[model samples]
Target chain A: MRAKTADKIATSIIIAVAALIVLVLAGLLGYILYRGLGHISFHFLTSAPETIRKGGGIGPQLFNSVFLLVLTMLITVPIGLGAGIYMSEYAPANRITNFIRLIVEVLSSVPSIIVGLFGLLVLVNLFGFGFSLFSGALALTVFNLPLMVRITEQGLKGVPREQKEASLALGLSKWKTITSVMLPISLPVVLTGTILAAGRVFGEAAALLFTAGMSSPRLDFTDWNPFSPFSPLNPFRPAETLAVHIWKINSEGLAPDAAEIAAGASAVLVITVLLFNFGARWLGRYMYRKFTAIK
Target chain B: MNSIIEINDLDLFYGDFHALKHVNMEIPEKAITAFIGPSGCGKSTLLRTFNRMNDMIAGTRIEGSVEIAGTDIYSDEVDVETLRKRVGMVFQQPNPFPKSIYDNIAYGPRLHGITDRKKLDEIVETSLRSAALWNEVKDHLKRSAFSISGGQQQRLCIARALAVEPDILLMDEATSALDPISTLKIEELAQELKDRYTIVMVTHNMHQAARVSQQTVFFLNGEVVEYSETERLFSNPTDQRTEDYISGRFG
Candidate 1:
């Protein structure tokens, strides 16, 4: 009778903990949507921000946000994916592999604020990249790599071992098997990991301040060239990303219309993340279907 | 009977543990040979050694020599890829790749650079028909290979092995996972294929071995106990261990 009572209590506790987590997630999402939507308008989305009217659009900041996003994704995706494949496929389970995995895990748990400081000291101040879009992308990549690696490794692990063996047995060299069988079989998992990484890259802001800085007035589009640094013609110049824009408008300049800009920026950030998640999910499913079709 | 494969005092080790003792045997060309053994008798291990599939396992080492058609299979100078291309293997389970039936046959040919669509189509049709699976699956070339029944999948895998046009085909208890009908179909396919390819199979069923194999080799405790005609091995095995196993007294 006493044991039965203990079991009942344990079940109730587990249920309560689960419900509490759901409640918190739903509450946070609900509040953000409600508050952020009120400030959005076509003008808010398209127009440029002003030091005077505050009502002026977050045009430059919005541009910066888009630029920053593309840059960060471009840099992080290849690197994170390569690291994932290396860890999952090439590296055997041993002390060195385990140690590298531990380091990546620790990076994931480190505070975003500390990441910001690391970017400031290691990338910007020490390396002299300055307050540009380049620094912001570098910082975001740091924030994103661990999550990307972990997720990618998980996805690679999900591929069937038989598929790999079949390819190898057919006389395909190591590289061909990796490209033809392992990577393709594990692609859906990799894409899922990529989506999760993109989500992290989009939502992150605490690490960008010291790296990219909080400048919002100008439209520097020059950083797009893979080779060159920040030029006005280059979109790669550390443009103020969307999250940074929200932080800047809400805290600095005392612009009266700052609240509206923050709301609009917040909405855009949420929408960007949602689009990435939904689009990647669709792509992953389509690829899986195409590959799994029987002859 | 030309010796297509020659194992001269071959030895295999997993780390320090010797798994296959100094073993000597020869497999003849264009013949169906069966290796029958108790569990842990090294029949499967000996079969995998021909294609270097055992390279996938860490800490595995081989000594002595395994030669196929005068090529040293385990030599450092030998290209493992080309060696495997000439020696094809099918596993116990019907592990068809998650692909279209056409792609399943085309996979090996494509690797050898036969990418023209019409040529691929011909190979697919010919391979499937040879495996006796084309008539049933003629209308569904683009369907998933996995969607078929287990028996059909096993045949499809055989077709995949044939598509490569390998000189030797190895089956490791290939029918062990199938229903009786599927087993019979595969056994029939094996007999037909033996005319074109040297076939080596490891099977536990004595009846299956007798029905399909021309030559039979009985192994016990990492050594070959006897090698002779399948009928002779079953009816007049000279070795005590081979007799005991054939009589169902022990594996």
Candidate 2:
């Protein structure tokens, strides 16, 4: 065969593979929106679910997902950034550091279902945290922390060596160089990773199932006190996230309109994840510009 | 001329590999001194030793001591940060931070706890003026440092190094990555800066050494072949290696 003809065939095959991925994604999104958009309303978004009734909503579940995400991030970001900086900047190339990196890689690849089982055993039973939002947040941290560390390390590593040298050569302390010079330069990558992790937290079901529980107590939205048992702000209360709610309604929900509720909740979850992905790209670009002082 | 830097039996090693062997020299204050050599001959390594930049590398060791301003820099009592502040350095590549022109110049000052806005602005202006970059970039101080040409960025880097007000300036082939025009500009800037700051530069171009340096040191295979006045080294080299290397017979 002619080289030109073979090159043309290879290019076409690559393009076709890329097109297939886009097509599959578009079809999945279109089907979910088609089935769920008609059922969505202000009442449906804000009201509680009704068992044995045709009308049901996922309002509390949505709020729980958002709240759990915030909680998990509050726990994860500091630890992740610290560990990452240690790995990239401070840690000597040695056996222990290599072992730690290997562990992080192995942990990230572990299945989410396995993480849920581990959470159930340790957080719910052994630690006596019960099935609460805090337990769920902890489980999600286990699932997300490896990714956050890897991303943060990679981001910091991506910064040119010259930048670090320049700052240090200017008599900046090691801490100051890492924080002011290195962190700002690597912020875009770190921010993107954080948002990607948030998207995972939002759509995670198996991990939350055994940790956060499949039921929420009757929540008082107006009760802003975190110490109150009935307050939505309480981390100790049992909660069901949007993804878990969808899974439950599909499996054994007693409501008459369980399928419709599942579909609507699934659509909302998909949209929120999609929004997160787009937000990651936009925020990364915006921050990069801000840091670089480029218009 | 008063000697500001004195190196005594300085031998440097990267692990088992000897990088600088038995180097000894006294560099004069407020004058330009140039180290000229081929790649991997330890000119750059010796330059890095002045600010202790070599400490960043693993398994690098040095014997004897490097004294600057009557103080042994390698002693345990000496602080690397303070030593670096006193001895500023420019690299082979132009390394302006990914920040606004104003911020890039202000970065060094801000690190040493200079916070008053007016004082920072004055420091920025004078530093840029010293680097001969103020006239070109004054109007667009808010623009990114990367927005300018290669030559302009190199000047900005020089300005950044100058902001801390160091007593000695080290340029590790600062203009090697630039065009001839930019190289000429930097050569002129080095000439102007040496009267205020003790400037030590490493250069591949022998003409650059003769043009700007009062004293020139030639290195070969990790050893100083010759150290003398620039005019004498070029016009009447005593060593066969230095004479051959300068006349382009061999490195």
Best by lDDT: 2
DockQ for candidate 2, C-alpha atoms: 0.80
Residue A201 Cα positional deviation in candidate 2, in Å, after optimal superposition: 0.4
User: Among all windows of ten consecutive residues in candidate 2 chain B, which has the lowest summed lDDT?
Assistant: B242-251
DockQ of each candidate, alpha-carbon based: 0.62, 0.80
Give one digit per residue, the lDDT tens place, for model 1 in B1-251.
99899999999998887889999999999999999999999899999999999998889999999999897888889999888888988888888888788888898889778879999999999999989999999998899988889999989988888888889999999999999999999999998998899999999888999999999998888888899999999999898888889999987
* lDDT tens readout by residue for model 2, B1-251: 99999999999999999999999999999999999988899999999999999999999999988999989999999999999999999988999999999999999898799999999999999999999999999999999999999999999999999999999999999989999999999999999998899999999999999999999999999999999999999999999989899989976
How well does candidate 2 match the true structure in TM-score terms? 0.98
Docking class of 1: medium
TM-score of chain B of each: 0.98, 0.99
Segments of candidate 1 deviating more than 4 angstroms: A1-16, A220-236
Report the lDDT tens digits of candidate 1 across residue range A1-295: 9999999999999999999999998887777778878787888777667776657776666666666777888998889988988998889879999999999999888999898898889888898887777788888888788988887888778777767767677777877777666777777777877777677767777888888777643553544454454344354355566787787777785778677667767877787678778988987888877876822
